[model samples]
Target: MMLYYIYDGTFEGLLTAIYDAYYERENPELIVAMDNFTDNFLIQRRYIDTDEKKATKVHNGIINKISEDALTNIMYAYLSEHENAGKYILEYLRFGFKVGRLVDSYLSDDRVHNIHKLARKVSRERHLLLGIIRFRLLSNNIYYAPIDTQYNTACLLGDHFAARMADQIFVIHDVKRNYGVFYDKSKWFISDIDTKGNLDLHEKELFYQELWKKYFESTTIKDRLNPKLQSHFMPKRYWKYLVEMK
Candidate 1:
């Protein structure tokens, strides 16, 4: 008999699914987001809701039994949004319960390897965005930047930028996800946004944009052009929001 577990697509929902898997004593052959579920007469389907208590239980279990790095990797892997991410995370936890923290060291295991690999990709993208994100000063004096990443990475960038620009207000909008982190000098929080709304820019914003473009033009050596190397560091997809690229 094939059992499928469908979840609400949130991390907590995924955790709740893991909790039910253990207490219910049923191993799911397929774990997927609820929206992705389809009708199948051969498979028994279960929809798991996001339960904070159950999610916390699983979270505490991971932190205590496994390592903090393991929990972090699980989060990163979930954020990867891979098609089988839910199933992979459930399998990883199932193995982690047996060997405890040593589960991470089992790189030979396919499930463990996949979790770590997904985490590495997410981490690399987060690091790359730190240097690539460009901010534009708005008329309200708030520094606003728009990002459209393929992965869910905007949430990971808040702490890094907040610490660097502690005294300034800024907004990092993930256009692809329709949510952003808004920091007002003292605190920051994530919220949904409408990217199509009017953005009142500072009077000198255009001047600064031209200046940046001119600087980039003057600094580039036409004879020493390295399109391959430049593209390697800064992917072309991110060029849309860059002032210099404009």
Candidate 2:
């Protein structure tokens, strides 16, 4: 009979499940996130809670035994939120432990390739948002920027902006997840946000937005429109946060 290991839908929980799997000497057929788990009479299931100690142990194993890049790939895969992502992460880690740093060179292997592929997608999104993310000054002097991403990438995006804009107080709200990074000049932290309604903008913010829109309009030549090419570079979904689109 195949065994299934289930965990709460968190990175820590997933790491704990990995720790349990190795400790028990069991190669579970599935390492499923609870949000994606389904009951099956044929398969035995065990649920694992998020344990910081266990998660840290597994994280240390990955970093010390495998490679730092492997840990990065695991994080990116977790953020991918793809179907059976937990299972894939476990499989990748198991393979990584055996091969050490060379696990990344196994491009022909489906499991290794998938991890790389998912991580690439996440890296690509993070890179795009770094350039396109726009911030507006709030009524209370906070720089606020709201983004809706298909991948759970706000945390990664937050880290990038925090380093670049370390001197400014800002909020990078992930509207889809109802959470944001609150940066207070000295440091940045993630927290839940109240996204119930539209935020009130500063009076000057409105003026700058209008000025930006005008600049975008004035620079464009109607005769040279290439929407297909433009859409290739800038997907239509991201236009919602763009000042020019407003």
- The model with the greatest lDDT is 1
Local distance difference test, candidate 2? 0.88
The TM-scores of all predictions, comma-separated, are 0.93, 0.92
Candidate 1 lDDT tens digits, 68-121: 988999999888887777788888998999899899899989989989989898
User: Per-residue lDDT of 1-246 in model 2, one digit per residue for the tens?
Assistant: 778888898889989999988888878888887877778789898889889999999999999999999999989998988876777888889899999989999998987988998999898988888988899998888999989887888899767787899888999999888999899998888999987757789989989989998999999999999989988998999999998887
Off by over 4 Å in 1: 36-43
Candidate 1 Cα RMSD (Å):
1.8
Q: Which lDDT value does model 2 have at 76? A: 93
Most TM-score-accurate candidate: 1
Reference-based TM-score, model 2: 0.92
List runs of model 2 lying over 4 Å from the truth: 1-3, 38-44
**Measured by TM-score, how close is model 1 to the native structure?**
0.93
